[model samples]
Target: MVPGLPLKNTQASTGDTFEAAVLAGLSRRPRAIPAKFLYDAQGSALFDAICELPEYYLTRTEITILRDRAPEIAALAGPGRQLIEFGSGSSVKTRLLLDSLEAVAAYVPIDISGEHLEATSRRLRADYPALAIVPVCADYTDLPMLPWLPGSSGAAKLGFFPGSTIGNLDPDEALAFLRNARRLLGPGGALVLGADLKKDPGMLHAAYNDSAGVTAAFSLNLLARMNRELGASFDLEGFAHEAFYNPAAGRIEIYIRSLRPQSVRIAGQRFFFDAGERVHTEYSYKYDLADMDALAVPAGFVRTQTWTDPGRLFSVNYFVAT
Candidate 1:
């Protein structure tokens, strides 16, 4: 079981804010909610399941690259650096870097899901007893600053942002995030970023529209979350999960569409939906080396090295803040 925030408490703690967000999102045209809210304990568990599905090649492919290139990555990052991960999740891929880095100063895993972060931190502490482990619970994108790494004033900071989570942000938001990250990492710091490469649209569609329907469940859970936390009367049966690759946009667009006309009440406000009306859920953008450079350069990072799998399905890049 995940530690720290319990399900009931998680719901309670985020209730007011979530209610406000839900109301605001519904108030807007072409309704949408931030993707970060999708990772409640239950949703996080579902996503872990999605990663294991046969069609989901991203997780396994990235892991293979990390496994093969960790030593080389460590060499680039050098010795006694403080490691920080954004959207740390289970911190599964971190093991490769932790084992390879020489005399690491500390490990900090920042995540929005308190339960997930706490549980992962506990396991990591047990496994790597000597290393300092600090887990910060916050939305990494909006986080103002990180906690100070004790006794490591002069140590380099290496940011680990695997899993292509950066792709969820729009281009402007992504550039802003990269800029914020550059400031946080400071001079002499480095980042290891994972990006999904553009590929056959059929393969991309298959990845999101999995055969087992786990992705569908994941997308629909947003509604269930509202019902539980925001006193929203959302009929799960009324909506259907839809996802497809938008090649022109170079991203996967996900949404929950109303199967039929329906009215839902939340926080004493009723909203009507027309048949087939949709609420945007998330976007996963694919990037090539040039696109990566475009993003990193203006953010004050210079790409030092990049590693990709045999198929070039994904890229792991090392960038230094200048």
Candidate 2:
């Protein structure tokens, strides 16, 4: 578990438990909030907008790779497979796989935002009327178990984790997540993983710090969420979104920085911020093929194939669980 963040208590509702986390995170030095808190309904919508930005090459590049490779991916997945997607946002890229896969037994899309998941599932149901579409609304990292899908018995679990969301987690957390996924996927399972490749710092900077400020809104929305759910008095305008590439770390670090000295109240508790103090919100780590293997191999996944665009900006890898 990340410092100051408590383990998910299965008994408590997500909203009920968020207050404690918000308070604990704010109380710590070099304050940081879990990135998952940034995915409330509004935040999720803002992120969808981010994907459409011209500066954001990740979405389009990965989509192109998935579009081009879906057939080949399907061939490896074989028939009667149950597709399980982690962090299935709008599931825009999933359509390609659904269309190409032969006789897919079921499709399970797990997401943190319930409203967004429901909306996406409805749209998918309409389009794939014959397919069994199960939408799980929970954090994929702490998901307890998947609902049993009827008629999916003996179907291979083909896990799809796209958009390089794995970058959001620290190395240890990423490894833990992959290990959990391997267990959830069970024997004869596989994962179609997308990862953003290490590249020019200029390009990386532009991707996260878009001129349109959609990414800014997406990052700041975390504060807005605290205000709404935890009765926190956060001045949204008082803080600015900061994102830059950390070359030494080989990742993009994002923070919500305090513009001036201020005090904020959350759940009747007060906290002060110094001028220019930053509260870390997210980290998007870039990876090379070797880095990916080093991370995934220890988690019990063997890389079978990898595909990248001509620019080599992003990678889509096919890994089978051992």
Candidate 3:
């Protein structure tokens, strides 16, 4: 059955052209582009393959932490609250949250990819027939206002932000995101966030640059997306995927470096790059407990509890709305 407006996932703008969106994003960061764009239907499928690669330990580590501590986190979430998730790509880690928060009446998954989001939501709805599924095909950074959960008279909300997607945002952007979340959640809501912590550079580099070459494929797929959607001529073979942890920057930078001097034309825009020059694709920032808490507190949240893997490679933090 189609959900009512109050329960339906709100889409900000479905008709917005993806090509125009990508171009504007490229202009914003001449050195890098948002990896979120790489999740076009095919790109999203490729990324699922990437997470399964043995070298990518972030997914595994986070899953372990969630599975072991979800019950406790759910208890903290309380009962009969709406579950709102941002950047809900695939939402694999969400199972732990939902399983723990059995009192939740709704599940909202927000994503930039319409096709992928719809498909995943449909499957999830089938599996969890008891829960209301609201999949929003909109950018998480600019989510539209949503209604309160059923059976609640403006009761408090619970936000589930899993997968350490927070690492993608820089310090300032991360702070802004936290502030925005705080505002949307209001005073009584709670936020459960997964964060990737600082770790060894070698481990970080390997997770991004895997042996099966899936990560490389995931990075290059952005160009493939452009070529297909924007009538651009990007020689996917002329570039190599390069990713490494920049310790100085406290982040992992993924770039598609030109194998040799190359000129790529996109949507009638011509750009030239010298040999070894690269177009940055993503930055996965790693933070410590103190750094994350410092960013969270000013945003009107007080850390309630944190669950981490034995290795301390990732942490799931529960914050009460202030």
RMSD of each: 3.4, 5.3, 2.4
lDDT of 3 by residue, 1-322 (tens): 2242222445544434566666665555355666677788888899889878898888888899889998898788788777888888898888778888866767778777878888788778777877777777776776647555455545567888877788888888888888888887777889999888999999998999899899899889988888888887889989899998989989998898888897778777777778988777778999898988899999999998998988888888999988
TM-score of 1: 0.95
Candidate 3 all-Cα RMSD: 2.4
Q: How far out, in Å, is residue 3 in model 3?
A: 6.0
Using lDDT as the measure, name the better of candidate 1 and candidate 2: 2
lDDT of 2: 0.90
In terms of lDDT, which candidate is strongest?
Answer: 2
| Colliding pairs, model 3 | none
Deviation (Å) of 166 in candidate 3: 0.6
Q: Report the lDDT tens digits of candidate 1 across residue range 178-223.
A: 9999988888999999999999999999999999899999999999
Q: Write the per-residue lDDT of candidate 2 for residues 13-61, one digit (tens) a residue.
A: 7786577778888899989989988998999999999999999999999
Residue 124 in model 2: shift from native, Å?
A: 0.5
Candidate 3's clash total is 0
- Alpha carbon lDDT of each predicted model: 0.88, 0.90, 0.80
Best prediction by TM-score:
2
- Clashes per candidate (backbone, < 3 Å): 0, 0, 0
